[model samples]
Target: MMTTIAAARSAGATRWTLTSLSLSMLLSSLGTSIANVGLPTLSEAFNAPFQSVQWVVIAYLLAITALIVSVGRLGDITGRRRLLLIGIGLFTLASALCAVAPTLNLLITARALQGLGAAIMMALTLAFVSDAVPKPRIGRAMGMLGTMSAIGTAMGPTLGGLLIYGFGWRAIFLITVPLGLLTGWLAYRWLPADSAKSGARRSGFDVPGTLMLVVMLTAYGLAMTIGRGSFGWLNSALLVFAGVALWMFVSIEKRVASPLIHLEMFRDPDLSACLAMSALVTMVMMATLVVGPFYLSEALELDAVGVGLVMSVGPLGAALTGVPAGRVVDRFGARRMTVSGLAAMVIGCFALSITPAEFGIGGYVVAVAVITSGYALFQTANNTAVMADVIADQRGVISGLLNLSRNLGLVSGAAALGAVFALASRSVGSNLAHPDAIAHGMQTTFAVALMLMGMALVIALRRLKAHGR
Candidate 1:
């Protein structure tokens, strides 16, 4: 066993060696959210409607979600290091294109390409981490990874705001380019170059499964985008697309051997529960990401900068807890940490829900801070649990599924919460600016999220009991 672990390490799996990889992953993850602040700039520069410009964000997410599983599977079959280099190279170039895009359509296209690059980066990073780290230390490594994610998520808007304020929206993309290039250069020097599992292997890509998953996610993302704001719940198209796509997705997963997502992975209580928990936690956490801006702007009567400042609190909480949560997971177990963290989140959300629109900005900031901290704890614990149980070979596929859940949660949070708020607002007086209505919708979403957290608790009870953390 010792020799095998060492050989795996020689296969480019080591804790200290992965510093570059983790940094690389962090930059790529940050790249994903960094564009949010520039959407208005993009709208004005290209003379495009904000609604249409929204697709620029949606397109990247869609592409990444659709391609990540396949890309991860491919990394396993081929080589993780090789894929990482390619992903970084492509992502860097795509950033350049986004910086120089002449039209909204062009920017959207470039962003889509960037998302594809990001998918590869994310998938390979997971696979490589799994290959490099020992089972005993996996929790620590996962904790660091979680910290990076929390930081990136928190900093994207803040960083984007500063860049846009300083040099226009183009600066947002430009900021990433130099860092990406530097990361790429460092990656080429420090990253392992192991040979892939060489073969003209007969098992090819599961085209049907891939296509079905893409269709399902695209339809779902589209439905969320349209259904959340202006599109009514009674829209037949949303229902039809959602139903059909979901059915097809499950069917494809069951039939395909090398399915886009392995169905059997769900059998693991830890994996299923953690994924679900992460999804729920993200939904609740991101509700702030989606709804907080509106609250600050419409309800509190603040500008974009003030709104961004208020929203930054949660990420700050996450950053503070990230490393510590991972350590807790390593020493104790996922069960206690996850439950406690989520409980914090629930409390935070409840507090925020009842906060009067007229409440002081300081009150809002404190609530946001709690939300951020809770999510950070949950994420660190959750990530440690998932990676701890899985074998190295399946790491990419598992990571891809995890990423899929997270993005789905974001889509769901933004859409479902937005729709609820819209309806509640309209029912009262078609005035979305009403704080009471927005708070109502946010609370409802929090309740649903709380239910999901309960489910996660059950999973932890069943799954982690025998594992003996």
Candidate 2:
């Protein structure tokens, strides 16, 4: 009777919500990886140094890291659905700007704007999905979202290659226009208008805290970026600015009525430890991704399409394993899966470190697949654990924090690991363009990755012991 009708409505809502959110996830994640393949093409097109052209990705990541926390808080206050729609619309507009930009500066600026919209959308995704699904099914819903993310990651390089070959680099950005529009329209039609709880009044936005956080992340990101270059003194100054901004952020958060971040959330050892582990895992994983194309192109003498096809294996592995990993987390708990994943990553890194340059594409494909399988397991479990640790009301902020952690990892991995590769290649008396140099640099990078994975494993073990897991 009445109960049956209510159940039917609930099921319909869940299906629509999952579809819309998953599509949004796919679009946003696609943006993260797609532009990577275009970096060299853009450099040649604009007649810019690789260092300057790298800002295309850095600008996007910097904006996301800086604004995610504040945007998440705003979503909580106003409404997640409202923020999501705005984010999608803004992202679509920015993508259009990026496609037609006449100069490197304009393209970078557009990317920054795109990242802002992406942060808003990313910050709301888990919150919105969690709201729609039942508690017991959270793991599965997260799995589905993770699968979409994996698909985007897997497809980005291959798709970018094909588009670039047929059209140009601009086609990469242009492709998103239609997809973004469709995702937005579907979201508007299917998503609940009032997904957020009623009676949650809007508090004053934390303007000072927001500004301080932006300064901190910006300074830190800039320092890391510059540190990768020959500008040592400028990098030092940026680091100092970063330190001061961090102090100001901590001081202001304690006094603000509506803080951008709830500082007290870190008091839970589980949350703090999980965040640290997540950051480390992402750092290693992204470092590998940043360096992989170079190894394929320089060491193995592969073209862009060949490199894309090879790199696709990693995310393909992730896409295949993501759902099962999530279900395993639900059944066996997060700690076991996390530790197992880290161990697998350690093995993968070791394999890459020792692999001979003569092994070529087949070896790399296998190594990357293994590494990304570990990433899939670790991320799905770690994300589930992070969400489970927070209270219902704090989900928005926690989601932001989780995303910020990963974004920081991405920024650091690119800068720090890129520096390592550069230095190691030089030590071999050849630049990265030389096959011998590429081999040395990649080996060094993977060795470093192995150490980081080991560190993560130790952290996970301690976390398990602390929680009596």
Candidate 3:
């Protein structure tokens, strides 16, 4: 009787565990793109300038970037299951706080906490999925997670817009609270206790190293977020903070007994290229998000809802592409798929760059769809590359680094593109009737995106050829 009960419990736990992890991935990816539709609404409600409102978006991403690595490592040190549940609970609470916040400052702070929870969910979802499934099904499981995540991200704008129009911006955060709470409860009850990497013993946490890393990432975020706008390039304070933080981060990591990051991972050529490609792709991906919406609303005179629908194309493409890309990667290797993906992205960005406001709303929508499809293809292939060569014990670290690279790209993209558009718009001057100013700004931003794609293309092509040899 005891044995039978234990077996049934194990089966039930496996079922719930997979379900919970899937939900976690969906939520994390959803957050990345969902708030976009509410940007205009939030700006109006909070009585904040556009640039400041942009921080509401930036703050969450910046927090995620700064903390993902630490949290990923800690998850491995502790148990992935326990950490995941903790993250979920925290995230749920933060969501509630965001829903009821009276001021922009409070909302931003709550979102940051929400981001911390997101990092935990993003970090452990894959590992936990692998643990629950048999080895033969791991590839399929990963592909499914990627697909669902892509769908969530792509649907963010549309979903957000619908919610905003129907029930207001508060509903956007509130609706997720119940889902998060349910996922957390399930995870706690079902996730196994021994989800840590095998033979990975807990050394005392590297307190100093961790602090330095956080300081470095935080400084980087601040500098990127405000350096160009508030201080300009010549600001001594900005330069000093960024420089000192980076230097200290490097120095601390090199000396720590159990380093937060294992520098030795870069020794493999494939891994190095994968990391570089991931960073570049992310930079381009995030930059496009900012530029695409601005172009639609300002240049084309589309409303916020219209921009959301148009912006939805890229994520939609990604959702359709992820599963197929994963299968292709498993069969033909990362090199071929990655290179092809980059080529597609180049075409898409170029198409979008050349598209004029005169093309009308339908034309612009088509252009965005073309560009987004390429984004989807590239992301799926690139992620597969990162995961392919990684050992089981190190997946969390690798996942953290992948997320970090992407987040850093997001920060860079937002800052660089935001500054460029703002500068161009200023030169053209603030005549709302003359879409030319915003048009020129949009063109400039797209050109920059094109240049990024070119670099990524070169890297992906080189990697492909090298692998072929």
What are the RMSD figures for all models against the true structure? 3.8, 2.4, 4.0
* Model 2 Cα lDDT, one tens digit per residue, 39-90: 9899999999988888898888788898888788787777778888999988
Cα lDDT, model 1, residue 116: 89
User: In model 3, which runs have C-alpha deviations exceeding 4 angstroms?
Assistant: 1-18, 36-56, 102-106, 129-140, 164-168, 189-200, 227-236, 423-433
lDDT of each: 0.73, 0.84, 0.75
- Per-candidate TM vs. native? 0.88, 0.92, 0.86
- Residue 457 Cα positional deviation in candidate 3, in Å, after optimal superposition: 1.9
State candidate 2's TM-score: 0.92
Q: What does candidate 1's lDDT look like per residue over 166-244, in tens digits?
A: 8899888888788888878777777666654522332655778877777777777777766336666654586588689
lDDT of 3: 0.75
lDDT-best of 1 and 3:
3
Report the lDDT of model 2 for residue 102.
99
